[model samples]
Each structure stands twice: as structure tokens, then as C-alpha cells.
Target: MKIEQIYTGCLAQGAYYIVSENEAAIIDPLREVKPYLDRLEKDNVTLKYIFETHFHADFVSGHLDLSKKTNAPIVYGPTAQPEFEAIIAEDNQIFEIGNIKIKVLHTPGHTMESTTYLLIDENGVETAIFTGDTLFLGDVGRPDLAQKAGSVTQEDLAGILYESLHNKIMPLDDSITVYPAHGAGSACGKNMQKETVDILGNQKRTNYALNQPDKESFIREVLDGLTAPPKYFGMNVAMNKGGYDSLDTVMDRGLNPISVEDFESFAEETGALILDTRGPADFHKGFIPNAINIGLKGDFAPWVGNLIVDVKHPLLLVADEGTEEEVITRLSRVGFDNVLGYLKGGFEAWKNSTKEIDEIKRISPAEFAEAFNENSKVIDVRKIGEYSAEHIDNAYSRPLDTISDWVSTIDDSEHFFLHCAGGYRSMIAASILNSHGIRNFTEVEGGFNGIKKTEKFPVSDFVCQSKTL
Candidate 1:
């Protein structure tokens, strides 16, 4: 059996393409299915199955599109409550395509209908187990996500997770390799190691969740340090429920070619979101009021998704005319097809037009130090684990994933200052606060590293906060 792990760093997701002899199956599909299909076609393998580890909450999956395009069945665990059409895959249920033997294992930890796939070679030799979210290289999936959505309590799901870990995953051969749907930077797991893969024996010996003193203890530890999943998670889940219509390519968004006067009219009437995709520094220097600052430096799709897109408004992007196609393609990959059009020239055109703009201030380390002591409060938007491990003393912290809640914890009357590991989340978070009329704010340029390098921190060095910044 041959397997390929496709990693999407933007979402920190890992999907699989498993092939043996002449047939293949793809697992935990991203919204775009053509990439997987292209692989199968290029490899001369017939596509046979599309498997979803579970009804994902983080991003939309392409299971429906794959099934529709290839005439392959969408496979889910027997207990899955999927709204769309899918085969109810039962535990130990076996199917074959060419020489590949597919065995389904109903692992109900991450979600009620979570399923893992085990593959056998042409000679009937068991090869590996695709554990999905049930097991990861160093950690296990958080029990909280699917439970609340499915009307299952965390305690109930934790019980299921314990059983899945001990009874199903643990029983696999020591040599059986394990594959998971999520990796580092994903909210699904608390401490996923930075490894591409792992063996059953290795996980059993080293994975903290797997080595718990007892099932109860494991569940407690697993949920304790979790950063809340993104606010868009549930929205994505509902979207993938009925299944999504996939894109062929970047949709040919017609350039309506509005006159400059008409562009301003639409900006006033239709409420087009003008995204200044320049540098954060440039945006902070000057840009449009209500124009969100999503610099091209970070992962474009997710930042755009988190900051801009919704089921609500259409977007008017402003990129260097050179990056127009690049912007469209990235946004399309995330299912944000609401691109009305792009600004003709760039911010320079806007500046020339006397279009109104706003500026976000990037505070210096000394300025931040003064703010840290006197001017304003600091907000750390790093992950929960990262914050708890070590952080700027007495600063308000909630990971970027939990920004919605982060604000709720603080009184809006008091100004909230924002910072992240680097400058990414700080810009995003500050943009959020700035929109809410919290204007007396700024991000410590380069975040903690910037603050550290520019001035001696008032505290000690615990973990490597990166002078490499």
C-alpha cells in the first residue's frame, strides 16, 4: 500500500491519499477536490472512495464534491448524523477495490461518528491504521468540539474518547502506523508533536493522552490546556453538513469596471469591504477607515476568512494590480467567493482619489514598555498553551482562536492592547478592537520577540520566545 500525506499549512490540516495496486481513496478532504483527483489521474490510479474522518468543524470538507465527481460513495461512521448522503460505515465493515482491503473502525472520541480506516496489502497483510482524530503523533483530539454541537456533553464524549483510545487504537499492532487529520497550529489537539507521522508503539509510549494514568485523568488533561476553536468553526460545520459545491478554479469574477465615482457610490451603497492587502506597517501608516488591514505577510485565506468573510457582505479587495489573480485564488481556496472586484491600481489610486482612510499605529518596544507600565493594557493573542507555558506578566491573554471570547473577558470601557507571538494576530486582533472604537491601541511590532530584542524584558527567560525574531 502507498500513502501520501497532503498538508495544508494555512489550516494546519492533513488529508490522505491511500493507494494500492490500481485503486485509491482520499481521507479528510479539503474544500478543493481537484488536487486529489489530479494526483490520482497523474498516478494512473482509479479513484474509489472518499472518506471523512468526521463532520469537521474547522474547515469545509470536499467529500461531497469528490463523491459527486468520481461517482464514489461518501463514507462516514455508522453513527454519523450527517445531513447529506453517505454510506453508514460500520465497525469492522470491510470493502475492496482492486487489491486494497479497507476496514472501518468506529472510533467515537473526537466526534460520535469518527471513523478510522485500516488498509491491507494485496497479499492480505495489514499495513497501517488511519486513526483520524482519535490518535495523533503526540496528542489526541479535544473532546469539546463535537460534543456541544451534537448535544453530547464533554463528559460523555470524554468517555467515548477513553474507550476509543484504549479499546480500539491501543489494540493495533505496535508496528501499525498512525495518521491523523490535524497537526500543530490546529485547535483540535493541545500538544500535537511536530512530526509527520508516528508508529502505534511510539504513541503508546510517548503520547501524553495515551499514557494517562486512567481514562478520567486523560480526559481532564486533554481539555485543560485547549485554546477555543475559531469562531468560524461552527459555521463551517453547518456548511459542510449539506455538503458544499466545489470550485473548478478561481471563479471568473467579471470586472464590472465601475467608474471611480461609481466605486465610491458602491462603497457607500453596497458596503464593499476594501481590504488593504499591503504591509501592516503601510496600513498603520495610512489607509481607509473601516478598511480592514490584512497584510499579505501572513496566511491570506484564513486571515481573510476570520477577519473579513461571512455569509453577509461582498468584498472589494485592494491588492497590487500584480497580485490580483493570487488574491482571488487564495480567497477561492477558502470558499470566500464573494469577490465583487479589485481596486484598479492600488492604495495609491485610493490616495489619489481622496478616498477616506484610517491608520493603525505600530508601537515601538520602548513605547510598548511605557504602555505596559502606564499608557494602555496589553493583550496576548497567542495560543492558550503558549500563553500558559510562559507569557508577558499580568497581560490579558487569549489565543487568536478565542478572540471573540477574549474581548468579553475584558471591560470594553478599558482600552485593550494586543500582541501575538509574531505581529500577525496582534494586527488582526487590534484591527478587531479598532473597529469596535478601541482606537487607543497598537501592536508591539514583532510581538514578544520585537519587545524582547528592542528592550530588556522585565522578566526572566523561561522558554525560547525567539530572539530569532
Candidate 2:
């Protein structure tokens, strides 16, 4: 079998392509199907089947488009109970594509429709299994999504997931390799491996959930550890059922260079919030006063949600020359569509205009500890749920998304020392606070772990966050 791992940098999603004999099957395809079609043509093969392990919750799937374009049979579990059309597959169902033997295993932990496909090469030896979100490398898929389209609870699904893992997924051959749909940056599951490839033996020994003493303990631990699925998940499910409306092509739009005088005039008239997408090193050197510095090097969208800006408000991007299209794409992924335009010529244009630039105060962990001990009010800007699980000493929790509502809770009488998991979310949090007429805000240099050694005391006791886990 010819297997290729396809990673979509646009959405940070991944999929698999399996080919045997003269036929090819795609598992968990993205919105754009042309690339898959071209692959088939290039390899001198015909597209036969497209499989969606489950209705995806992140980006839209290309299953429908692949079916529409190729008229190939689309397969999903009979109990998928999806909103769209498909040929319902049953457990233990076997089919031959070229010389490849495909076996469908009904594993309903992540979603009712969730499945894992076992493949045997023409040599009759088991090779790899496509295990969707049902089983990840170190962590299993979060079974906390609402089940049966809208009727089931996360606990209900999690219970079934327990049965599925112990009874079905765990029984596979130790040599069978595993391929999951998403990786590290995916919200689908926390603690995802950096690489998608994992052998069953390796996963069996190292996967925490897999190491539980017994079934009951396994159920409790797996279900209790999940973070809340993102808000956009439901829409993505329906999108896959109906088929994703993928971009035919990414259009590169250019922004003309603007002088500082022009930028100032535009900012005053349009009131577009300036978005900086450069790295921390570049941003800390100099920036437009009051501009938010949530760089695009990391997951920029989720943090966009944490931004206190009103979604109804407009935004102007300060991305470098090649990143204009990317900034727009990532923002749209997170449901932010209010982008006005980009700052032409980037920082160089501003410098050429001779406008004064300001540097945001970035501090090391040691300095942050001394300041935090003496006079600073530590603000953890992660979600309320994350803050509850683990947090720093003397840190007051104001979730990134809802901070504007609780600004008054802070005395504004102390030095504001802020941090998030990494620096990205903190940068975003700092930018939000700065925009809200609050000054004296300093973003922690390394975020939580970067300055972790500076702790004057032990990490604070935590509570079970309500909404997430």
C-alpha cells in the first residue's frame, strides 16, 4: 500500500492517502479536493472510496466534494446518524480496493459515527489503521462532545468510548501503526504528539489512558481530563455532512504602502485596530503605540477569541508582505470576518514615515518573580477552565475573552504582571488590556513555564474548572 501523510498548513489539519493496485482511497480529506484528484491522476489510479472517520469538529471536510466530483462511494458507520448522505458501513465490514483489504471497525468514543479502519497490504500482513479521533498517540480522543446530533451527553458518549477502547481498539495487533486526524495544535485532543505516526506497541506502553489500572478507572480518568471543545465544532460537523464549501483558490491581495500620516488619518477615521503578526523579537523592538501584538507564528485564531475587541469592531492587519492572505485566512477560520485591510509596506513604511515607535515592556522570569513578589498583580489570561486546573501564586483569574467585563476587579493600584501558557496568548491578553484604556501592563517574557523557576512559593492549589473539564 502507498500511504502519504498530507498536512494542510492553512488550517493546521492532516489527512491520509492510501493507494493499492490501481485504486486509491482518501481518509479525512480537507475542503479542497483538487489536490487529491491530481494525486490520483499523477499516480495513474482511479479514486474509488472516500472515508470520514467521524464528522470533524475543526475544519470542514472534503468528503462530499470528493463524492460529487468522482461519483465514488462515500463510507461512514451505519450509526453515524449524520445530517447528510452516505453509504452506512457496519462493524467488521470488509471490502477490497485493488489489492488492499479494508476492514471497518466501529469505535464510537469521540462521536457516535466515529470509526477506525484497518488495512492489510496485498501481502496479507496488517499495516496501519486509520484511528480518527478515537485514539490519538498519547491521549485518546475527547469523548465529551454531545452525541446523537443533539440528544446525548458527554458522559454518555464517554462511557461508550470506554467500551470501544478496551473492547475494540485495544485488541488490534501491536504491530499495526496508528494514524490520527489531527496533531498538536488541534483542539480536538490535548497532549497530541508532534508526529502523527505511532505504532500500537509504543502507544500501548506510553499512552496514559491506555495505562489505567482497569476499565472503571480508565473511564474516570479519560473523561475527567478533557478540555472543552471549541465553539466552532458544531458548525464543522454539519459542514462535513453537507460537504465543505472550500476555497477554489487562495487569492493573494496586495496592500499599497502607506505613510504614517496616512495610517494615522485612516486609524482616526476608520478606527480599525492594528494587528501585529510578526514574532516577539521583531515586535519588542518597536511597534505602533497601542497596537495589539498577537503574532501569527502560533495559533492566532483561538487567541483572537480571547481578544477583548468587539467582534462587531473592524481590524487592520500589520502583517509582513507575504502574510496578508494568511492573516485573513486564519482570522476567518476562527469566525472573525471584520478585517478592514492591511498596513501597506509593513514596519519599514512606518519607519520611512518617521513616526515615533514604542516598545512594549518584556520581562524575564527572574525579574517577573521579583516584581510579582514586591508589587505586581499577577493576571493569568487563559480560559477560566484552564486557570482552574493549574495557575501561578497570587494570580487573579480573568479569562482572556471576558476580561473587559472584570477590569474593575483589578485595583489598577498595583503593577500588572500578565502571563498565559506560552507568550502568544499573553501577548494577546496584554494587547486587549492596553486597548481598554488600561496601562501599566507588562506581558511575562516566557509566559508561565518560561519563568516557572522564579516561583517564590509552590504553585497554587487548583479547582476543577466548571465549563471545560
Candidate 3:
């Protein structure tokens, strides 16, 4: 028997491939299914089932497409009322894949249909548990995301999660390996460990949620630091529940190369968003006026999901030549399937054609330190937690994620300097601000990290009492 954890770093997600004899199963697949198909072909195994822990909210799952291609049944736990055809397995139901057996443990807390699949080896020894969102290495899944209108509250879900862990998970063998869906960078769980796989015994000892003395404490602790989830979460969930466009079709539409003239005309006609997927440094040099920069090198998909919010928004890409397919694939992973096309010949074509170009004013950290004053307007675009921990003495705490809410509050007459931890997020913020016609700010070259290295400005470690300037 072979078990492979296919980990995608960008999403911080893990999809499992388990093979025993000539049969295999896939658990929690990403939107792109070709890789899995190729793996099955190379291994010469027949895909017996496509297993989903729950209807995911972060990225659209490839269960529908994978099932369609392989004729494999998509399996979920009880109470999962998906619009598409699936097998709603009962609690403790046993499924055989050649020499091994999979036992379904209905652990519903992250969502009503959340489940953990227990793999029993050919020798009948309970080996590993794929705990989808229900349990992470260092933390449990946040209970607030699954709340419905006037129905199950977050507290109630937390209590259910506590029961699920103690009843179905904690009672299992300490030596059993635990494989979760997400890791530290994911928005699914706040306190997930960086390690993707851990022994159940280690989690019981170190995971805060698993050690809670009572249900009340577990609920309060789990719900404590959770901010609002990304706005595109619900849209992805809807697509995962219902069906979505085939990834093949999405790629065909997005890979088209549009001429500069046609690109501008399409933007005007459809109001499509121009997304520039280049590094922050290169993007700062020059870009098409009003294009938003969310670099493909960083946490591109999550940032796009958070800032853009609308998964169906038509997008015209301005990617580094040869990376258009990658950008489109990443966009489609998060359910952004309405890509119009990419800028033909990359951004150079637009510049060569004498199209109006815009540039962001960036100053070195030394320059910023030389110009620092108590009265100078500054914006810290890091997370509130990071800003509160340590920031410039008088900088306003306007996080990049919440820019759409506080952007209008920026005074046009006053100039501001913007910075993030290492400049990537601030550049993104700068581009969005420019797109909105609020371009009175100059970005710090290396953001707060560079500012700290200068040792010229006063850094405040005081906990922020207020968010205002």
C-alpha cells in the first residue's frame, strides 16, 4: 500500500492519493485534475472513488470533473445534500479498495458533512486518519464558517466539534498518523501547524483545542481570534456544491492572446478587471494604467480571492510572458473562470504601442527615515495583529485586506507613505489605490523590514489601542 500526500504550497492544502493492489482513491483534490489522471496512468491503477471531506469554501474541488473522467463515485459523509450525484456514506461504513479498507467516521463540525477517513491496512491495523478541516496539527477548524441563518450557531458547532474529536478521533490509537487538509497559511484554521502530517498522539499532547478541559472552553478558544473569512469563500462553496465549468474550457478561453487594441476594447465593453501577475518590483517600474498587481510569486490565489471578491468578474491578464497559463490555472483554482485573455506579447506590447502607462513612486527605507516626522501621513498595510505587535509610532493601521472599506477615508490633499512587511502587499495596495484614482501615496521600497534595518525611525511595540490615524 502506498499513500502520497500531494501538498500544494500556495493553498497550503493536502490532497491524498492512496493505492492498494491495483485500486486507488483520491481525497480532497484541487480544481486541476490532469495531474491526478497522469499519476493514475503511470501507476496503472483504476480509480475506485473520489472522496471529499466536505464542500470546501477556499478552492473549488475537482471531484466533479475527476468523477466524470474516471467514472469513479464521489463519496461524502451523511447530511451532505450536494446538487450533484454523490454517495452519502453513513457513519462507520466500510469501503474496500483491493487489499485495504476505509472506515468512514462522521466528524461533522467544520461543516455539517465534514468527515475523517480511517485507513485500515491489509493487516486490519488502523493506520492513518485523513481529518479534513475537522482537525489540524496544532489547532481545530474554526467553527464560525459553517453557521447558517438562524440555525446552528458557531458555539453550537464548536461543541459539536469537541464531541467529534473526543468521540471519534481522540479514542483512536495514538500511533495513527493524522493528515489534515490545510496547514499554517490557510484561512481555514487560524492556528494550524506548519507541518502537514503528525501523529495523533502528538496532536493530543500539543494541540490546544484537543486538550480543552470542557466544551465551553473549547468553543470560546476556537472562536477567539477568527476574523471574517475571505469574501469569495461562499462563491467557491457554491461552485463546489453545484457544478462548475470544466477546467479545459476555462483554459481554452483564458489562454487566448488579445491584441492591445482588442484588450482595451474588451475591458471597455465588459468592464473586465486587468490583473497584472508580475513581481512587485517589475510591476512598480511600469504597467498599464489602472491594472491591479497581485504577483504570481506570492500567495497569489488567496490575495486575489480576498481583494477581487467576485469570482465571476471577467479578468484580462498582464502576466510575465510564458506564465499566462500558470496565472490562468491559479485563477481557476479559486473559481475565477471568466478570464477574457492575456495581453499579447506581455506588457511590452502595450508600452510599445504607446498606450498610457502608470508607475508607482517608491522611496528607499533610508529616504523614508530621513523624511519621517510625527505629522507625516503613513499607512501600515500589514495585518492588524502584525501592526499591533510593532509598527511605526504614528502610522495608521489600514490593512491591505480591508482597503476597500477604508480607502475612501484617505484625504486627497494629504500625501501618505505605505509599507507592508516586505513590500509585496503594499505594492498590491498601491496598485489598487491607483486603480481607484487615489494616487497620492508613495510606497516604501522594502516595507517595514527595511525600515527596521535603517534604525533611524522610532518603532513602537505598544499594543495598538485604536485603528485610526
Q: Against the true structure, whose TM-score is highest?
A: 3
Q: Which stretches of candidate 1 lie over 4 Å from their true place?
A: 148-151, 253-261, 299-313, 322-337, 366-379, 384-418, 460-469
lDDT of 3 by residue, 341-412 (tens): 999999989989968889999999999988888788888999988988899887788889999988878776
lDDT of 1 by residue, 256-344 (tens): 33444556677768777766677766777777676676777677667776655373357777676678766665665556666777777
My TM-score estimates for the predictions, one after another, are 0.86, 0.78, 0.98
Q: How much lDDT does each candidate structure score? A: 0.73, 0.74, 0.93
Best to worst by TM-score, what's the order? 3, 1, 2
Clashes of 3: 0
Between candidates 2 and 3, name the one with more favorable TM-score. Answer: 3
Ten-residue stretch with the least lDDT total in model 3:
460-469
Total backbone collisions for each predicted model: 4, 0, 0
The true-versus-predicted C-alpha distance at residue 39 of model 3, in Å, is: 1.0
Q: Judge candidate 1 at residue 126 and give its lDDT.
A: 74
lDDT computed for candidate 1: 0.73
What candidate 2 gets wrong by more than 4 Å, as runs, is 7-13, 31-38, 64-73, 81-86, 147-151, 191-195, 211-215, 249-275, 284-292, 305-316, 329-341, 347-359, 363-373, 382-393, 397-408, 448-469
How many steric clashes does model 1 contain?
4
Cα lDDT of model 2 by residue, 31-130, tens digit: 6577899998899988888888988777667787688888888889748765567778999898688998889989997888899889988988888889
* Root-mean-square deviation (CA) per prediction: 4.6, 5.0, 1.1
* Residue 346 displacement in candidate 2 (angstroms): 3.2
